[model samples]
Target: MNLFLILFGKIFVFLSSFLNLGSGSTWPGHIALSINKNFLKDTLTKRKFKIILVAGTNGKTTTGKLIKEILETNNNKVFHNEAGANLINGVASSIIKNSTFFGNLNFQYAIYEVDENTLPTLLKFFSSDFIICLNLFRDQLDRYGEVNIILDKWRKAFGKLKAKTTLVLNSDDPQIASLGKKSKAKVLYFGVDEMRKTELEHASDSTYCPNCGSKLLYKRVAFSHLGDWMCESCDNKRPIPNLEKLVSYPLPGLYNRYNTNAAVLVSKSLGINQYFITRVLKKFKPAFGRQEKIYINGKTLQIFLSKNPVSFNQSLMTVKGLKGKNILIALNNKIPDGRDVSWIWDVDFERFIDSFKNIFVSGDRTYDMAVRLKYSFKNSHQKLSVFENYKEALKFGLKKINRKEVLYVLPTYSAMLDLRKILTGKSIL
Candidate 1:
């Protein structure tokens, strides 16, 4: 039965790719799981490879890619689920595709960037060698509820982990760091040690201590709620990280520093030398829609996938650091993007409103985003433009910029995929 499922999944994936229907990242696995509830557990039961599960509100894809690349560079075979396909179906599909006809995975490592809500359920199916929880933020409230909900689920799951499992957590994130306290598994922490702001963003979540429900005090905030935090009531403070500083960072932004640090820590935990890891990281490229650059008709366009409030603010800060003059913001309220678009109001758009010369808005929720921009702009709205048609908006926005000026696009999850499809004439995963 398992063999038949693998063959069926492979055929579906091939046909999906051959016909350009879409990346068969999930459907095949969905069908496989529907047919057999224990598809994942059954297939991966006796696997020889070490499994790594990455879960968080953000940075999963980039960090997973980093680990995969570093391991491959060290001559170790590695495979990861397709980007954006982080659900159970995606996991099953990846297994089916990567495994041989007899359900064997020949890779030394299998890295999976798991969805926040799906982590506990995933753990029930199989035990991972390394479980890395990056950070938790208020994201997709409609889908995942709140940060505390995920924290509860994770803590419960962590309690069940075997001693052989290693947990790599973000020490700066109070919610994530607290998970290490009670877990039976060996825990390692990673955080950034650079200069940080004393202020927190308006949309900062998980500022309260996970131990005693006290408000977390921050000495310095990297961005949002992540930083050097401690609870005054209880003595619960940020754990001293196992790895913090790196010789060089492949990408820009303080958030990327955290992502890079997590990846470096995981690589080190795998017994990969720092010298070899550093060498591999120096040449690493940005994952798709993650500061990914595309050159079209002598113009350069870079995408920063800004889905939630904190992520959106981080993208704005990173683009500002790059001195981006032209900007496009796309907002979508699709199922994948979360039905509610109220989170945009929480983003610190006021900070970067006047920085860009041209700001174009278009998406399913274009008018909603435009309204948010209007409120942010207050008296001066001359720099803003809204187009109902995304293609028209993209064309006009590109034409507005000169050769030397790069167009920076900040988009919600679904909007990012749509914009990338239009620009690159291809679909990723």
Candidate 2:
């Protein structure tokens, strides 16, 4: 029975591969195979592979990619969902497509970027050898009611894990680090120690104590609510770092420092040697739309996608450093890009008011973005143009930006995809 199931699974993957539908389609096919318990068990049971599960509200994609690179540099074959399909079906599909006729995976490790809400569900079938929890923020209020709800669910789930599993946690994030205390497994924490970059100027999340609901005090803030914090009312505080090393990447903003440090610590814990990690860190480039650069007709345009408050602030900081006179901003309220557009108010848009020649707005909620910008500046001379259509906005914005001056384009997730389709002549989704 197992042999027949394996043969059928292989045939299904072989046919699916011919369609060239890309990595995104693999999850739907994996879901079809997971329905039969014997098929899933028979295939996955034969593999002796290390599993690394990355769960967080943000930075999962970027950090997971970094971890994969570190492992691969050591000649380890890794199987991962490159398209950010992190749900149960997506993970199961990646396993099915990558496994052999006898259900053996032809990879040394499986690194997955999992959604925070689906971590407990995915753990029931797939056990992770190492789990990295970055940080939790209020995101997609329609889908994930609140940050506390996710913390509670993860607390319960980590309590049931095996004692031998290694948990890599971010100490800067109070809510994520709190989960480490609940886990019976060996916990390893990573954090930033630079006081110069710790002070945050704006209102951020994670300001209150997760334990007693009292206002938490921060010794220093890296970005938003992420910092060296301690709760006054309870004994609970940010965990002591097991690995205290500063990462200086070429990327602008302090947020990347946290991400780089987290990746380095996790790679070291997995025994990937510090020498290899240091080499990879120095040469690594930013992922698509996360400060991706492109040239069009002898003109240079930098594209940065800001989905949430923390990311928006970091991207804005990077843009502010560039000597650009022209800037394009795109906003959307799609399901994937986040429906709660109110988070825009939390972003620091005042910093770039006088830096740009003109700001062009596009996306489904372009008018809302325009109003937000209009409210940020007192004078109308800053130049704000609103376009309901993205193509028109891009053309108008690009035409105004000369070849000598750099154009900084910031868009939400869906808008980024739509912009990519227009620029690259291909739909990545």
Candidate 3:
């Protein structure tokens, strides 16, 4: 019975991709769920495969990629949700594709990049041996409501975890670190030291204590609100993470350092080979569009998926460190992009005006993005160009960036996908 369902779903996935309609990331699993609501629960739970679920708002995809590589380098066969599909259906699809015709799982391990909001429902079907919760922030306000709602959902969901299931979390994020309070499992944490990054963004997501509602104070901020924090009223402070020394990572930005820290902690807690983990950290490649760089015609084009404010700010910092001038930002309001384009205003773009020589804005919501930039770059002296379409924008972007300069592309979710298709003739999703 399960084999027949697998065949049916695989056919739909094939047809979807063949027609060039989409990446077929979710439709197959959606149809499979319609046929058997217990598909994921029945298939996944029946297997002896040890599963590790990576869930959070920002770093899920990148962290999941790192963990997957570590596991594979350690000689474990892993099946992962690659390009951030991340929902329940996507998880189901990843499992289904790795199964034999008789519905037996071929892999020894499954590392799923799960959506933060879907963690409760998805875990109801299957429990992970390890759960890596990176951090939470205000992202896609239309879809997530706010950070607190998901925090409550996770609190309830984590309460159901078994005693043996280890919860690996970022100690800097009070909301993420606090999920283990009710869980009977062993909780492990990872965080940067007190002197990683000091300057804090003016607009941060978590500034108050989750328990006492007192204003949170950061001793040293890594990015946004993630750092060594303490609450004066409740005496809640960032946990001293039970982790070991990690080799330096090649990935850019302080955010990537935090991500590597989280990955190292989870890998250690899982009893993975430390030698392999350290080597993988030193030799890690950019996951998907997370700081991926390409060289074209003696010049370089670096792509950073800055869909939200914190991520955009980090990308801006990365460009600043490299002393880049050619910057192109793409915006889109598609379903995956949260349909709310107002978040662009929340990002700190004014700081880059004096440093940047040329800035190009384009995407589905190009005009709206351009208007947001106009407000910031009005006083600063910088060459700004706007295009309503991506094609014209890419032409201008490629032409403006000289061989001696590096062009940095900052794009939202859908815009990143479209940009990849235009550049490499392939879709990552």
Indicate which candidate wins on lDDT. 1
Off by over 4 Å in 3: 15-23, 194-199, 378-382
Candidate structures ordered by lDDT, highest first: 1, 3, 2
Candidate 1 ranges with C-alpha deviation above 4 Å: none
Distance from true location, Cα of 302 in model 3, Å: 0.9
lDDT at 156, model 2: 87
lDDT of 2 by residue, 1-429 (tens): 555544665576666566755444354435455566544344554568888888887788778878888888888999986555777666666766676766667799888888889898766665678898988876776788888888889898899889868888889888888786767888989887754555665647677787888988888777777888898888778888876566466466566666777788888887888788877877887777777887877777788888887787777777777666777888999888878799888878886677777888889999888888998886774598889998898888878888887778889888998888887787665
Worst 10 residues of 3 by lDDT: 243-252
Q: Which residues of candidate 2, in runs, are more than 4 Å off?
A: 1-30, 37-46, 195-203
Per-residue lDDT of model 3, residues 244-312, tens digit only: 235577687777777788787877766897899977877889876788887766767889999888888
Estimated TM-score per prediction? 0.98, 0.91, 0.95
Lowest summed lDDT window (length 10), candidate 2:
22-31
lDDT of 1 by residue, 316-397 (tens): 9999999999999999999889999999999999998888899999999999999999999857799999999889999999
User: What is the TM-score (0 to 1) of candidate 2?
Assistant: 0.91
- Which 10-residue window in model 1 sums to the lowest lDDT? 194-203
| CA lDDT scores, all candidates in order | 0.91, 0.77, 0.82
Candidate 1 has an lDDT of 0.91
